[model samples]
Target chain A: MSGLLDVEGLVTRFYTEEGVVKAVDGNSFRLEEDEALGVVGESGSGKTVTALSIMRLIEAPGRIEAGRILFRGEDLLKKSEREMRRIRGKDLSMVFQDSLSSLNPTLTVGAQIARVLKHHTRLSRRARWRRAVELLAAVGIPEPAKRASHYPHQLSGGMRQRALIAMAISCNPKLLILDEPTTALDVTIEAQIFELIGELKEEFGMGVFLITHDLSVVASFCSRVIIMYAGKIVEEAGVHELYAHPLHPYTRGLLRSIPPLEGGEARLQSIPGEVPDLINLPPGCNFSPRCALADERCWQVEPELSGITPGHRAACWRAERPAMAGGGHD
Target chain B: MIVFLSKRLLLAIPTLLVASFLIFSLVHIAPGDPIQVMLGDFQDPELIARLRHEMGLDLPLLQQYFHWLGNIVRGDLGISITVQRGASVTDLILQRFAVTVELAFFSLIIALLIAIPTGIISALRQNKLSDHLSRIIALLGVSIPNFFLGILLILFVGVYLRKPWGAGGYVPLSRGLLKNLAHMFLPAVALGTAYAAIIMRMMRSAMLDAMSQDFVRTARAMGIAPADIVRRDIVKNALIPVVTVIGNSIGYLLGGSIVTETVFRLPGMGNLVIMGVFRRDFPVIQAVVLIIVVVRIAVNLIVDLTYGFLDPRIRYGGER
Candidate 1:
């Protein structure tokens, strides 16, 4: 499949007061057109950094050191700020977490959506407003015309998230990056949001880069999943393939830790150690210290991501060995 | 909205009443006798006692208070005791209050003009050379008091430059708006600079907070121009706290204008109050202080209403 977005050797660093933090170190991945790609990692695993780097939204003390961000075969890094401004919300859009904070507090939800249309489209004010209401209704908000005039704080959490989604999809962007869009939402609302996102992706034919720590979310929504640890992607495979036979130790740990929701033993499994400090990551492999199967060679030299099977890749040295099959989905 | 306005209006009555009582008691307790000040060098004790009786000071404190309060309810502020002998306090205040109001209005305008832009620029270009330069200017503005700044303006722009407009004097707007503004400009600058500095600092911090908000990032991600994000989102959201600061500082502004007007020799309320204090004009002092309190209360109410307007989540009168 032709890649809609290809990120190659992306290195994003933050020069904080403590030290240099390699937040997203040498991350490489691709998103095909009309495909949903999942990026799974814990809190400090640089998943958000990767998405922000793609948007070129990194602020002071944080810089994208080296990378070629190719969007539909066009190098995005070469674009100036002005050029990027035009491309954003038209060609690329992002739905951030924390809907309450993501939406502007002062402006009405309708005005906020209309603002995006005003920037990207040639519609008149009335048409822009009508489109805003249409988008709200599309995202499943009740009484779109009435709700559009309400401020963010006046709306429920689910409604606010829906409004944010509406705004992100206002211009029918080619690529939509959702950064843990359901983290602050309840489970029922989370399912609804994912369903809405799925429908929107189908309707608009847009590529989605879904970033979350929820493995189940990735399993249910993303076709291809990439597992990251200490800012490096350690495993990449189709969702079913990865869940069935996780090649990397970290991925296996993550899969084992997903508690069963069926008639089985309720013992919860957790990865043994905390994520390594990004500023002073362990040598060889960032995950080697916590890796249960790491050997002397694994401690001395880092392993590259090698093809384990036809469409699966893992960075662990033991991928060649027979896969242990206990963590398969029920 | 009607319910809210009426509630606020009802609340203001007791507030003004309490303020008047406090003003009368505080001014009376101060170490001065208005009759003695009025009858300077008169050695007749009977005449002094008679003057005190005539002014109602010979009665019990509560009785005198109630008598004054009763007259206030009837819309008579009594006669100025010394500053302008036999002039009605209300008339004296009415004449001078306009000047103070005008000064405060122009000074506030100046402050807003200086603070809003500087604050926005400082925040947008944070840590840059221009931001640093603005910080230095704000520091200077805060450090140098207004009266001292007024004197400096007089010396440099008025005396040294020999510019007639720079000298200290009052020019009523009735003569010429241009001349009046020129006459008021120096004092307004002096009075406004410190407040501008205060507001500028608040704006910078508020803008910084607003800029870091998720909405700003969303705006940027929406392909909105940087200028539009700042204008539509950052400034409007940032202004909520800054408005509170501005509203709360109105009292301080009125107090500062007292000194500012004195230095500029403007016949404002501040000049009236200062002259009254020195001459023990009890009626003028009480009336001016009461008027100031009322104005402050009204300003605070307006601020609350404006808050409702600016933030839709803050609903007045139970309307969702």
Candidate 2:
């Protein structure tokens, strides 16, 4: 059976003055209904680009060259702009990272939420406003009626983010793409946001495409996760299994880099090199230059993301061999 | 808001005082003497001195300033010495100011009508043919001087087309609205084109900025219609900065009206001030300049108040 979201062979590129930046190159993934799929990637690793591509929001100079974004058994890539718009915010919605920038400063929080309802539903203006307040209340905001009339700047950071979430779920979308939804909040607020997302997911039965760089966040919140590097998916697997045995070296490095809560090494382990420039990436594996086990063969040929275990996949020539000693341990 | 308004108004008293003092001092400090200009070839020292005493010009400069200030407090703006000899400066200014206000209002309407739509279109279609065309038009608008544009309009519409209303003149509102508008149209265009260019460029940049804002992307991601996104998200946000530019440029419009009035032969404040300067009519010049200063302060206050209306984040008084 098909999942709620199945992205196949997605190739998004930006044709800039310097060169064509392969932002998302031949990545494929599936998100089951009512499941939280975490997309973990560093900056410029095509996490946001992948989300934007799914939304068909790539502007000029940045085009989705190839992709089949199948949403709910319907190919979203094949839909027209009008059809895509109707599907967006109704069947599919997205929440951004920076709530302050994402919410219109000039418009009240309630009005912004009401606006989404205005377009997506047949509710009257008053009803839309009432529903907007209800959504705000549902998102754990205090005094929803009074808070709805307040502008984005008037609210605290956490509240603004909640308001944004309220807007995203205003129409009860089947798939909600959250791009680092709580990255700007404090740790406590971040945990609260995830809890709210968890509640909202259960309430709406929505598939969440949660994109972030925080692996711990993904481990705690997502059932499955994909690790992206240099605009490519380096690994994909169940969260628990992947954490127990991270097959790829880059994934191992990311896993090891997370600081231990109690007694451990004073310094955190980090990947050796910078993410390769998309325009002039290494000929072989994108992370080969940074891989300690990279040999002549690894440097000459790029590996396809192939199945290693029953439900785990990794794109590394070394993954076929036994797990490297002294690695994958916190 | 009331507290803000009252504070701004109270602050204006000192500003107006400084402005009035500068007007009085500068007009006095200038070389030309009103008595000499009025008497002309009849340069009798005794008669000139007598007239000077009668007008209080012979008094100590400080005392004369106070006398003038005292008269202004009583709604007296002194008498015009040369432009309209012995005419009450207050009545003369009121008549001319009405014409100037009507002209300025018409120009503002014309400028906004042309600038806003074109600016939005230009920004929406940036780097397109329409955008280039508008940019070119704006450049031409700024390049051509107001007097030259006015004369060109008169030549084209009056001399070439032979339209009765195209010739330089003014018609009172009582004459007929259409006739008055027809007469005011060319002058307004000439005075407004340059302002339209400035505002259009500002609007274009502001719109471009607003378009790139994250909120606009959020609106799009939420499935808001493209037109609604442009209207509700982009345009409203863009208008905030553009309103500031419009407020700041009102002074430019009033200043440009001087040349426009001269070319169009309208008896507005510009013409009155110009004639005042040429004939050393200190009362007319000083009164007109002082009024312009006061109007500028009031416009600024209105602009500040408008910010509260446009963006709720900008709270005034203790409500913040």
Candidate 3:
């Protein structure tokens, strides 16, 4: 009957030479129990930083300057480093990007997985070993019992990602954050990963936070979609509704940018102007500079996330009702 | 692997030849002759000529180098002029070289004891008071010459502890391990303290670098205990660079121990070389230098092989 995670007014900034760069500026969202939310954005939209801030993995010069991240109603920002560490594995886990670099190169897959078990469970050595093998098998690695004994280098990109997944889900965490989960793999492996996630999500009803730039993935698996721009959520709605009727200019632009495959020409449309620099940003709206329908009001006023319908929001001054058909201006 | 060895081997030939050339030239070019130093108080010019002729001092420079190289290849480094019926330079080195090895072994042990924990703590608490304190300690070690530190340690041990500095002679490690260890501690520590500082600083930097790697974050996300992260994740990855520093430290220790030995009044290889330098004993100096070079090379090769064990990503010949 309630949300598994509730992040509100989350503002993260990096103290740099020029000025504070608001990496995640007053962004907020939530995931209900057993829900999967996809975050789609261009680079510098604070996609990764938002995920990192939730995990309390922000390093020096960069820190959560304001806001609350409530996991199961416990304020995560107030937790001690040690406490946050415990929550990271036991409650919320992350399947990191770049499995080649994410997996410890020195340790075997089994040893790496065993470490997760060791952290959250008080299992004996034998129990940990068996559990590591079982987790590896669950992730669909071939000869898992033996494969777990091999180091990260011995595995291909897909296998390394599976090992990362095995480690992430080891504790049956309430939430799993997959940052660009299938972005590094080929189509077949990507399909395997989507299917594996489906299987695991069914087995353990953990909420999923999928962060990627791929719009297709949101269409495929996400229950809800949150579109971000310049470190702020511009639009949020159910996956079906958002794709069919993206109200925010940025979201509409992104949807139209995906090229089609066929005999016809595939030239896609794109929004002009790069993402606004977080440091020394122009005052009012960040996306206003690139907006097509910008007015004096758009440049002078900061648009807050406002509901256009129940459970749907868009931070746009000129948002209109979506057409009944798939998203289009006609 | 063979290619690497061949490369190392080809590189070593030039290195060894350059060393041989320098030692041979400096000894010959210097004003005083070894014959004069050996037959001191001899104003007789005829005896000097006879001795110089017998030792092949009359040969041209290039001829002498080839002759020496040929003999060295045949395992006959020229006989020691100082010691009567002077043993082959290699044999004399082998006998005395063990003492230096034993001392270096103790130094490495002492260095490890001081470095590993200090470095790990420094990196784990990076930029905190303890980390600053460790940095200060390392800086002081780097700033102050080891010879000054050596002298200070000897004085501290003598004026305060009331332990005799050079009264007990050397005890062979094989005959009595405990006695040998106790006897070597003061000198070894004097030599090892600098190495410890070096290794500690290198390890701290390496661990700091490793700590920032993605897998380290991955390990943290796995909720691995801080201690386990330091041990299994941080240290394991950090070890490669540390090994390189320590391998290089071996050369520093053996080369620098000469001054420390002089300060402590010990009869180690350093002291022996200093004595040979005063007496102008070319054979003993060459033998000592050669032994130091070979031992350093051995340590480096051992370090290279160790890299294979430390990181699976590093293979001897790399991946096919």
Best by TM-score: 2
Better of 1 and 2 by TM-score: 2
In model 2 chain B, the worst 10-residue window by lDDT is: B311-320
**Per-residue lDDT tens digits of candidate 2, residues A1-330?**
899999999999999999999999999999999999999989999999999999999998999999799998989889999998998888999999999999999999999999999999999999999999999999999999999999999999999999999999999999999999998999999999999999999999999999999999999999999999999999999999898888899999999899988898578988888999999999988999999999998898999999988789999988853444454345
Interface RMSD of 1: 0.8
Residue A127 in candidate 2, Cα distance off native in Å: 1.6
Clashing residue pairs for model 1: none
Q: Candidate 2: DockQ?
A: 0.82
- Interface RMSD score of each model: 0.8, 0.9, 1.7
Residues B1-320, model 1: lDDT tens digits: 99999999999999888888899899889997888887778858999888888788899988988988898889998899899999999999888888899889988999999999999999999999999999999999999999999999999999999989898899888999999999999999999999999999999999999999988998998899988999988999999999999999999789999999999999999999999999998888988888899899999999999998887778988866
DockQ agreement of candidate 1 with the native complex:
0.83
Arrange candidates by lDDT, descending: 2, 1, 3
Instruction: For each candidate, give its TM-score against the true structure.
Output: 0.96, 0.97, 0.91
**TM-score of candidate 3 relative to the true fold:** 0.91
lDDT of 3 by residue, B3-42 (tens): 7767777887788778877877776676775677888886
Calculate DockQ per candidate and list them. 0.83, 0.82, 0.61
Write down the TM-score for model 2.
0.97
Model 3 lDDT tens row, A1-330: 348999999999999988989899998899998999999999899999999999998988998989989899988999998898788877899998899989889999999998888888899988999999999999999898999889999899999999999999999999999999878899899989988997898899999999989898778888999999988999999988887777888998998888764644867899999999898677777889999987898899988999888888999887885544345555
